[model samples]
Target: MSETWFITDEQAAQQALEAWREATVVSAFQAHQALDDTGYIEAVETVIADPATTEKTRRAWNMAQEFRRMSPTVLELAAALELTAAQVDELFEYALTIEA
Candidate 1:
């Protein structure tokens, strides 16, 4: 007897995205909170005002900005993962609402 299991590319991509989101966002949020407590907002502003800044601070500021803009649509997520429209739709049926 033989058993077969089938999984589409869309399913695989969706699963990967879901896992990535959970891991990345959760840690980013925690780091943001810690930075927030330490006057990180002022630090970001300072870096922005000054053309010359330490690489460490600039990296941190960039990370904070990236996390702030973390909202990902199905299309954006799909593009990032190189998923086709059909694959994205298979995982994100709700994307149809945006199309209409």
Candidate 2:
């Protein structure tokens, strides 16, 4: 028989909030996959290819091992992606669940 574990709604909410708070960083692969799954991969690639994006930002995007939720580049990219604050948070939350 399979075992089951259950948590109260309040406890689940607290755990989810904690996970969101702790998910400040995720692997580059995870980030990319999350974007792809959400249908924003092409949009992000377009933004990266835009001439307005700085060379430094492009370098970080192309080479970083992990992405930080609040990094300047990420914030800029989120804006460029036309994602609202909640959307950015959701993306990060989803990315955190991804395994390498």
Candidate 3:
């Protein structure tokens, strides 16, 4: 017999939405891979090339082991990419699902 979940639509949506709200960090690879998967690579390249981005932020972007949600680089990128808070949350959540 097949197993079935008894979750209702509202419950499922709530659960999904709630996930990763508290997740503030992910590996750099996960972040990049998520962006690539979501077709944001070119946009990221543009962000990297933007003159407003400081050398420190570029260095962090290129070399950091992990990315934090509240970091300046992330905030800048999110703004440049026009990603809403919900989209950032979804991106982080999706990034977490990627295999190393």
TM-score of 3: 0.74
Alpha-carbon error at 9 in model 2, in Å? 17
Residue-level error in angstroms, candidate 2, position 43:
0.4
Model 2 Cα lDDT, one tens digit per residue, 1-100: 9999999999999887767645589899999999999999999899899999988889988999989887888889998977887798899889989887
TM-score of every model versus the real structure: 0.27, 0.76, 0.74
Candidate with best lDDT: 2
Local distance difference test values of all predictions, in order: 0.45, 0.88, 0.85
Candidate 2 structure, TM-score to reference: 0.76
Lowest summed lDDT across 10 adjacent residues in model 2 is found at 14-23
- How well is each residue in 27-72 modelled by candidate 3, as lDDT tens digits? 9999999999999988998888889877887888899999887678
> Which parts of model 2 are misplaced by more than 4 Å?
1-23
- When 1 and 3 are scored with TM-score, the better candidate is 3
lDDT of 1 by residue, 6-84 (tens): 9899999898767654443323444344434534435445544565554554555456433321344223333434556
Count of clashes, each model: 0, 0, 0
Stretches of candidate 3 off by over 4 Å are: 1-23
Name the regions of candidate 1 deviating beyond 4 angstroms.
26-100
